[model samples]
Target: MLINKAHQALTDDVVKENFLKYGNPDGPSDVKHGIALPKFLIDGPSSPFLVVIYILMIAVILPIFVNSWWDGVKSYTKLGLHVDTTTYFLEYLLNYNPAELITIEKIIGFLSHAKEFKLYKRSLTPEIVQKLLLSHINRTQLSPSEEQLKLQVVAIAPKLIIGFLDLAATFRNNEVCFQLVETHRCLIQALNPEANATVNKYKEILQLPGASLEKLDTTQPIYTLGKLLKKPTIDPSKFLNIENTKEVLDVAAQIPLIEPLDCKFTVPGESYVPPASTSHVDLRFIVKSPAQKSKPDVSKLSKEVIETQLKDPETLDYLRNPLKVVEDQPKMPLYSVPPYFPDVDYVRQHSGWVAFLILQKDGGKLADVPNYITRVDLSNLKLSPAEFLESKAIVSAYKFPLSTPTPNVGTYHFRFVLRHLLYFGSDLDIPFVMNIENKPVETKRDLYEIEDPDEDSIAGAFAQMRGESVKKFEHEYESSDDEDADDDEEEEESDWSDIDTDTEDESDEKK
Candidate 1:
């Protein structure tokens, strides 16, 4: 039977062709490479055991993934901050009293409580931090252990601040980023214990390199960058060494100071705003580029020149297009390198200023959500100190569109605050007023009342002819109405007399 079947296979045309081509009755077998497992694993009791192991693995891993996802969802907020960390900050800030002075130590203590520190140092705890703060508040010296912990916190602070700045930038939160920058600068200032607390508080001078408490504590009392630049006679080099002085001046030159030229609140095209009209605040300001050692005297241009410049076509164009469009800026590098700040893999940069309007009567509360000013032209920094100061002022303008119309006509008092993002003491608060004009009352004439036309003109001639005819007809009509009214009165009198006579006759008959 096997021989018969083999002969039948060879007899088939397709099989015969395969046999002739490859010397085999059947087509070539497909070669599939796979792992060779033991018979016991594939078909024995071990197979069911392996299936059980697989189910167990999935059961364990699935929960872990789900738990991880849930934890992530719970951990972060919309601001990209840990939920607990934000809660702690909110609680700390909420309890703060405006009357109570906020010191660097208090700020540090507040920051030390942040939960992010736990990720860096497991040893730091609330109890330890509370003790550290209590001791400091009591004016007691820190123990060696406490001192070490404080150092660790200080070291970690820049990284925390940088992280906050990163998150602020990512979220495009200008106010938060500005606050974080100020905190970062304050943290740097806090490192110098030798500096008096008051002197350390002056972030403006402290930001300058080699500007120690001693150098800044000179007779002139240079607390601000403007003060430092304005007083050239009190040479900074005299107090700060030559090399350090140069560094201070160079950095100072880079810092910008805003000198407001004019401010107006008005509608764009119209000269006056009627009641219930839209208007915007126009703030014209020149960014005073800081001089290395000292700023030059006020611009040589007279008031007339300045006024003429303000009305220039270019200036008008700037006012029309107040907001300057800037390309996306890369993160700024830390002015101070390592040893000052930890070697964190992060870049620190100034975002810009926060411009806001505050109603003076509303207890200085914000009138609107703040706008971010990221496009201040700083190309003037590259110029020489003298050239920079003398250079044509960078006329930047800020416009705030009043959201709601002024229904009632009156002046509204507002304070325009231009706060710096990276530095303290560089804010501009200019008070301005907006007036809504009263709408004019229109006196409409009655349709029947017509003015007499000119006598010499054709219209006057026609009106005169028509007027003569109208007056003659009015006179005749008035005479006829008068005659009719007299006759009616006479007839009524006669009727009354007849009634009286009849009453008298009736009385005589009764008698």
Candidate 2:
């Protein structure tokens, strides 16, 4: 009796609100009024109208989310995804006509594929073949609904079936079935033999070489860097006052405008190691030595006498290098190496000798032209080209452990590579088809050609191409004179800032 009274106590207006709000849950009013007057507005459990409404809403949304997930799952499935906006279908067709159009067709093709099979191979039977067809019918056949709706179109154009099979096969194996490959090959041959031959040539190479084509050298193997640097062949005999011959100077009459990573680090108390690096910028080689061999010698022997008196070519070669570079604008001659050099140890402490040589562009001459070369620590600097040379990255540095033959405990080393970023115009375009004589020059894919070395500076080019040419320095061969400017010291690095100096005088400038 009390429960009945309590239930009756609820007004009809409120009950209506409760039904529309709580049980029905159509909006905010539903929750406020329907929320258990005192108990759970869900009086006995809630009305079924609201429950059915919520269930319908969920059913409507669930398909959308599931369909999205399924689309992702079948992203690579061609037949399921192809709807015409894709641009990759040209070469992906495998063949124009697919072999496995129907399940029986596929079974027939499979059986025919091995007519000459050995006796142990499974023999084709109609029942087995029919079952196989049924098994893969989903792959080769169209969805019934789609076929039913689009049948008129498919019937009017029978080739549509062939296309469906091709698309399906592409999804299955990332290639058109065998029927397509042969059919296209035959059609291609029938179309034009010459064009077919040309295409076949590239296909042959692609199928044959795979990746080994990158290994073969095709360019003129630059064997001797001696020609590039114009540095006379060095002979130890000339340096120690032994018998010598005057050598021909490797100087080019004209200076060619040349534009241009390893690490053996020696941290104060650690072993040396390395990473690949790149850098670039002008090297202003200011002649800093009073003893620059290029300076006019005040000896009475004179030019002719000095040239001839040097009985050995190696001796004459020495005079040619520390030559004062002629910097007459638009046509300046570059030096082989810097002149009036400083002791590497002098700068190795404040900065690394390697960095100083290759990275003197920021504060010194050519200071205005933004530098592009930088030292990479994680090697992410070396690998990522855009971020590495961005204006935001004028310079970057990192410290790593290094090793040296020296016994010094405070040794520190770092390798800084400079990248020679070539700028030609506002925009650069990849060569699509370099045509000549009305025909394409099908580029020969030789590694040497692809690995074209820098050819701007003769000396730099020579050094790069023939660094290990003659095995010039033996392992652990100590320099006889500490003042030799580290010639035998593994060429710490190369830099452009010292173009105006002489090689021999470079040693004295550092200290």
Q: Which candidate wins on TM-score?
A: 1
Cα lDDT of model 2 by residue, 1-511, tens digit: 6555446435456555655565532224422444223444335466565556667767977888889888666543343323331223433334535453422234233332221121123453334433332323212344675334222221111122234334434344322332332222222111111223332232211111111123212232211222222232343123212232121111111111111111222212112212221112112211111111121222432455334321112444433431111111122112221111122221122111111111132322111111111222212212222332332111112222111122223322211322111110101111111111112336677766434334445554686677622223343555467636675443444343344355535765765
lDDT of 1 at 104: 44
* Residue-wise C-alpha lDDT for candidate 1, range 194-290, written one tens digit per residue: 2355654555765565655554545556667766666654777774544667766767766666767677776655566666766667666655545
Question: Which parts of model 1 have CA positions greater than 4 angstroms off?
Answer: 1-57, 92-104, 126-184, 188-203, 214-217, 227-230, 264-282, 292-339, 342-347, 385-391, 398-409, 436-511
Clashes of 1: 0
Query: Each candidate: what lDDT?
Result: 0.59, 0.28
Quick one: best lDDT, which candidate? 1
Tell me the TM-score of model 1.
0.56
